[model samples]
Target: MAQNKLAPIETSFSKLMGVQYPIIAAPMFLVSNEDLVVAASEAGGVGTFPSLNYRPPEKFKEALTNIKSRTKKPIGVNIIVNKSNTRQEGDLKIALDAGVELFITSLGNPKSVIQDAHKNGAKVVCDVTNLEFAKKVQDLGADGVIAVGAGAGGHAGPISPLVLIPWLKSELQIPIIAAGGISHGGQIAACLALGASAVSVGTRFIASKEAGVDIAYKQAVVSSTPEDIVMTTRVSGTPAAVINTDYVKKLGTDLPWLLKSLKDNPMTKKYVVPLIHLMGMKALEKSATNPSWKTVWSAGQSVGLVDDILETAEIYRRLVNEYHEAKQSLP
Candidate 1:
C-alpha cells in the first residue's frame, strides 16, 4: 500500500497507517462496526473495532473480511487486554491471518502481540492512560502509544494532556497519539505542538453520520455539555465518561441500592441474563428511557464541542482546516 501523507502532523503515523490523516478512531465498543470502520478509512482516518465486539471468532473474521472488501485505506482492530476478557492471543491470530494492517492493544502487555504483528509486517499501537502505562507500552516495542488523557470516553487517564504529553515526550522515543478531550482541529494542532505525533478521537466520532450508535445516543452526544459528563467504574469496573442521565443520578444517589434493585428485578433474569447477546441493543433501548444515559450511552466531556453530526468526510475536512489554521496562528 502506498503511504498516504499529511503535513500538519510530521510523524510517520499517516504513512505508517496508510491514511491521509493521523486520526485513529477509538475502538468504541458496540459502536465500531464494519460500516463505521469503512467510513472513517474512506475519510482519511483509521477506524478501529474492538475484537470483542464480534462475539464469535468466526464473526470477527467475517468483520475483517467485510472491512477489507470495503476500502483500501488502513483499518485497525483493537484487542482489549483487560481482566474481564482474555481473548487477545486468539483475536490477534485472527486479525493477522486476515491481513489486518494495524493492531491497537489496550490494558495489557503488548509485547506478545507486537512481536506477532511485526513478524507479520503489521504495525502495533497501544493505548495508555498515564505516563507510566505510556512508558510501559513503548518499552514493550509498540510502534506507538495512544496517550489517553482526561475526558477520554472509556477507561482513561485523569491527567491533562498538557502535562502528560510533555512528560512522555521527555521520556519516550516512540510516536505518541494523544487522545481524550480532543474534538476540534485546534485541539489536534495543540496536541501536535505539545509533542503528540497524532491524535485519537472517540466521543466525537460517536456522533458522526458513520457511527453505529442509536439516533438518541447520537443526539445526547451532540447536545451534551462538559459539565454533563460523569466518570465512574460502577458500570464496567473501569473509569469511563458517560452522560449524566437518570441512571447516573440514581447511581450517584445510591449505587448499592441500584445494584441490589437490579439483582432483585425480574428483568435481570429474564431479559438481561437469558438474552445476554442482545445486551447492547437493550442498553441502547434503556438509555433512551434510563434518564441517566449513563447505564449505556458513553461519551466524553468533548461532547460539548460536538455540536453538529456531520459526515466522516466533513469531519476530516474540518479537522484538517483547523489544524492548519492553528499552526499558522502559532507564534
Candidate 2:
C-alpha cells in the first residue's frame, strides 16, 4: 500500500512509521474504536487500539478486519503482556496473522512481542517510564520507546518528560516518543526539541467525537482541569491518573484495606496483584461506556487543555496548523 506523504514537518518516527504527522493517537483502552482509528490514520497520525478492547477475543479479529477495510494505512495495536491479561499470546497471533503493521506494548516485559513482531516484519515500540526498563526494552529490540512521563493519563512513570526525554535520548539508541502533559502543537514541539522523535498523545483525543466513549465521559474530560486529575492505585494495582470526581474522591485513592493487605503480603501479592489489575480494568471498562457506573474516568493533566468535543479530523487540523505557527515562532 502507498504510504502517507510527508507532513510539512517531519521527524524520524513519522518517517519510520510512514505517517505524515509525527504523532501517534496513543492506543487507549476501550476508547479507541474503528471510527477513531480510521480518522486518525486518515489524518496522517498513527492510529492504534488495544486488542483487549474486543471482548470474547474473537471480536479482535473483527476489529482488525473492519479497520483495514476502512483504511489501507497500517494501524497499531497495543498488547498487555502482563500476568493480568491471560489472552496476550492469542491476541498477538491474531494481530500478526491479520498483517498488523505496528505493535505498542505496555505493563510487562516486551521481549516476546519484539521477537514475534520482528518475525512478522512489523515494528514494536515499548512504553517506558524509567531508564532501567527503557534500556531493557532497547536490548530486547523495540523499534522505539514511548517515554510515558509522570503527567500521562493512565498508568504513568514518575519521571517528568522534561527530564525523561533527554535522559532516555542520551542512553538509548532507538527513537523516543514523548507522552504525557502534551495537548497542543507547542507541547509537541517542546518534546521534539527535548530529544524526542515524536509524541504519543492520548487524553486530548478522548474528547474527540470519533472516540467511542460515553458523551458524559467526553464532557467530563472537557470540563475537568489539570488540578482535577490525581494518581490513584484504586483503579489498578499500579498508580494511574484519573479524574477526581466526587465519586473518585469518595472511593479514595488507594486500594480498600483488605485488598491492600493482600497486595502487600509476600506469598499472596504475586497472585493478588494480577487480580487487582483485572478488577480495576473491569471497573474502568464499565464506567467508560456508561456515566452511572461510579464515573471512574482516566485523563491526564492535559485534560484542562481540552475545551470542547470535536471531530477527530478537526482536532488534527488544529494540531497541524498550530504546529506550523509554533515552529515559526521559535527562535
Candidate 3:
C-alpha cells in the first residue's frame, strides 16, 4: 500500500462527521453497499449507502451491523425523502436505531428528516440543486448541503460545481459538499479552494473493487469518456446523466409531451409514475448486476478520468497524494 504523506485536509465537516479526510463516497442507489461503505470509511474517508439498497427494515439493520462489525469508522445512510419511497420513515428509524450518525437526504424536502435525525443525535445533509433549495435546507436545520451540479450521475442538477460551490458558500452558512463532475484529486482541490467544506464523489467509486456492480459495468466506466455521458429525462421523468448505450440511445433525450404528461398526472402519479420509474431502475440494475452492458448504464462526466479498477484504499491514497500535489502546484 502506498503511504499517504500529504497533510490531512480537515474542515468543520470532517470534525463533525469524525472522518480523517474530507472526501466522501456518495451514496449511490444500488452501487453502494456495506462493503463499499466500510472500505471507504476504513480508507480514512466517509462512506455511505442508500437506505433503499436493503428491502426490509430488518435487512437494513443487519447491513448496518455488518459494517459496524468490520470497522469503527463513521458510516452514513442515504434516504430518499420523497413520497416515492413508502418505507422512508421506517427505514430512517431503523438506521437511527442502528446508531448511524450521518444521514444524507435526497429527492424532497428534508425538513422532517432533519428534525428526526437531530432528535436522535444524528447529522442530516440535504442534496440541493440550486441556491433556493440550499437556503431552504439550511433553514430546515441541515448540517450541510450537497450541491449536485451538472454532469453528475443519476438525477443531477444543471449548474456546474465551479459555479454552485462558491455561490452556495456566499449565501449559506452551513457546510457545502460539492458533488458532480469531480473525479481526480485536482478537481477535489479546486472544489475545496472554492470554499466547499468537502467533495462528494460517486462515479469514480463505481470502478472501485468494492463496488456492488458487475465487472462489465466497471469496465464500462473505465472505457467511457465524458462524451459518452448523456442527460435524458426518459429514464425517470427527471434528467439524469447516463452512459450513451444503444438501449439508452433508443429511448432518446425526450419523451413525447403526451406520455410525459400522463406519467406526471397527479391522478396516476401514485401508480403509473412509480411503475415507469421502476422499469428504468430495473433496467439499470439488471445491467449492473448481470454480465452484460447492453442495458441502461449510468455514469457521470467524470468517467473519463476513471481508467482502471483499483481497491478503495488505493483510490483514497491516490486522491490524497494528488490533492497534495495539486495544492503545491498553486502559486
Per-prediction TM-score: 0.86, 0.96, 0.96
126: Cα error in model 1, Å: 1.3
Relative to the true structure, how large is the alpha-carbon lDDT of every model? Answer: 0.78, 0.89, 0.87
Between which residue pairs do clashes occur in model 1? 245-291, 245-292, 246-291, 246-292, 247-292
- TM-score ranking of the models: 2, 3, 1
Clashes of each: 5, 0, 0
Candidate 3 lDDT by residue in tens digits, 1-331: 4434546788889998888898999998779998899999988888999987877778888999999899898889999888887889898888888888889999887888899889889999999999998898898899999999998999999998889999999999999999998888998899999989888999999999999998888999999989999998777777888899887777687866886888778887677666667767777777888845357787899999999999888888888888888989999
Among all candidates shown, the one with the greatest TM-score: 2
Instruction: Write the residue-wise lDDT of candidate 1 on 1-331 in tens digits.
Output: 1123435354678777766789988888777888888888887888888997787888999999999988987889998665345577888899999888889888667788889999999999898877777777777789998888888887778889999888888998988899999989999988988988889988888888877767778888999899998886555434667788777777662235554465458766333322332343355446634434355678888998999988776777778877888888988
Off by over 4 Å in 3: 1-6, 256-258, 291-294
Please list the Cα RMSD from the true structure of every candidate, rounded to 1 decimal place: 5.5, 2.3, 1.5
